[model samples]
Target: MAAYVGRGVHGQTVRLLGTRVLAGELREGDTIDLGALSTELDLSLTAIREAIKVLAAKGLVDSRQKKGTFVRPRAQWNLLDPDVVSWQVAAGAADTFFRDLAELRAAIEPAAARLAAQRRTDEDVVVLRAAIDRIAASVRGTAEEETAADLAWHRAMLAATHNEMFTRTDVFFAAGLSERDRLVHGAVHDDPVPSHSAVTEAVAAGDPGAAEAAMRALLDKAETDLRRATAMNRRAHDDHERGSTA
Candidate 1:
């Protein structure tokens, strides 16, 4: 399973098949043929099964005793799964995925910030400050570095809450948050350091209301940036399609 896990034939099959389902090449209720996939991909049946298991865990497919494996409805999909989030982005669902992620953040982060302000330990503050410093350092660096730092900063914020449920969802937030950071960074020219710093200061001050307000403002700005970025992407896609036909 480890050998078949990443960038290998098994993993590639998982991504290809996941992308197809996400892109609507395979719609809900559509069944897949194991034998056909094996022959077409020139992969062993065991490898194919391993790939399917990965997809299944993401709520993309279900297998019955004799019914084979079928794509699940969109409502059944676990969008919070990092792998699913990554597949959605890969399948050109960035606008929808990011919008949903922004909504989730709006609902969760403010509360988390408030809780962190109330419950944060000295260690939490230290880690949060370090993560913020990392973000500041990456402002003039590569997008990848900035994205990594941004994710770490948010993860640290969640950890500061001292709530297992909030911290446990960190993995689910990983890909979506990283993708959101990438899009917002590419679209907006504003320096986000001050906004982030505000949250840090509020939390460090043990001011719940102020921390919550700062976090809300940060999320609000992100949503605004995401809307502008999505609109630009839509226009570009339309123009490209028109050019292709012309």
Candidate 2:
């Protein structure tokens, strides 16, 4: 029987294969045969090949002349790839995935905010202000609105840096940051108006130091919330394990 059987077969295959590799069910150096997968998944060789191609594109697998396809090392995996990160989270490692994301944010966002403050144009401020308005509306609006606005806000800040490389990394931030925001908005119960506004205000004022400090403070709150959420997830997982054993 196939590991996955359903509609959107190739896309499902990509997620299933990627998730297994991410969850270590298929470890580094593990080789897979396309023919074997076709037989197991009840899929055509063409389907299996396409799925493997997608995975290879994402750096999850590599094919050699004689070795077939093998799982790449975790270090070789594109951690910044949104699909990879989404698979990692879907494989039930959301706590660790998001924690690592928080650390990455801590490293990059403050500096980005600082640069945005230093380099922002009038148009940038307008966009920032519009995003902030959307976020404020999220307090009373749909979850989708909040997530969209939050993403826009973060993307705007990154773009404000005016650094080509930094702007391009918005993809790295997308899935993880959205997940983090959902967890935070649900769990922390803190009003983000003041915190988000502080950063915007600092940027608008062209205060790099204040913007950096505000961003650090914002992320510090996020990290704290994530730690709390992770602890809760650990407890829940432990409880589930104990129950299963019982």
Candidate 3:
């Protein structure tokens, strides 16, 4: 899931089990049979146990005296973990994930923009400008390039806030945002450079109010583009289904 390149048997086992849990193939409270999994995946029991330890750290699984190792309730999950986010995105939960991301951005980013406008250094301005240039250059490039540029831009914006918590939040969300960008960037009708530039310029100008407003406007456009992209994808899927039946 999520183009993960597992490093070893332990890593591979973690990915396999993590993806299954996120995909709902292994539902909440369902016991994970380590011996069975070891047999099935042809991995060592130690590998399977190590994988479970990793998942437990991520809050995806837990053990109890009577229950054995079982999937935790979704509420217990570390949703902000990059691996968790990627697995959910790969599990066809992209729509819900995108919606949640939008809401989170709406709450955090405009305020971050305001702080950035107030606190950003000259170096921050340079980084933001460079990110914008990359975004502009990648507009017509491959989806991977475009997504990377967009993520870089956002990461720069968060870094400009000079707040550790804000920067950490961006790191947590980066994986999910990358997935969203890959899906929506190709479908968006409007050029993204200008909106991003508007926010950057406001921050560079040290205008907190303007920076906040600009960021809000940018998010509005992004939400609209996401809706359009989701609708188009649904229509395409419906058309294919109809054609299959015909």
Clashes per model (N, Cα, C within 3 A): 0, 1, 0
Residue-level lDDT of model 2, residues 1-246, one tens digit each, is: 012233586778888888988889899999987788889889998888888887888788999998888998888888766677778887888867876787778888999999999999999999999999988889766655777798899999999999988887777678788766665565556677788899999999999999999999998877787777767767888999999999
TM-score of each: 0.81, 0.80, 0.81
- Per-residue CA lDDT of model 1 for 138-219, tens digit only, reads 9888777998898889989999999999987676567787777776676666787888889998999999999999999998
Give the Cα-based TM-score of candidate 2 against the true structure. Answer: 0.80
lDDT of each: 0.84, 0.83, 0.88
Best by lDDT: 3
Over 4 Å off in model 3, which ranges? 1-3, 7-19, 34-57, 62-68
TM-score of candidate 1 relative to the true fold: 0.81
Q: Candidates sorted by lDDT, descending order?
A: 3, 1, 2
Alpha carbon deviation, residue 128, candidate 1 (Å): 1.6
**Pick by TM-score: 1 or 2, better one:** 1
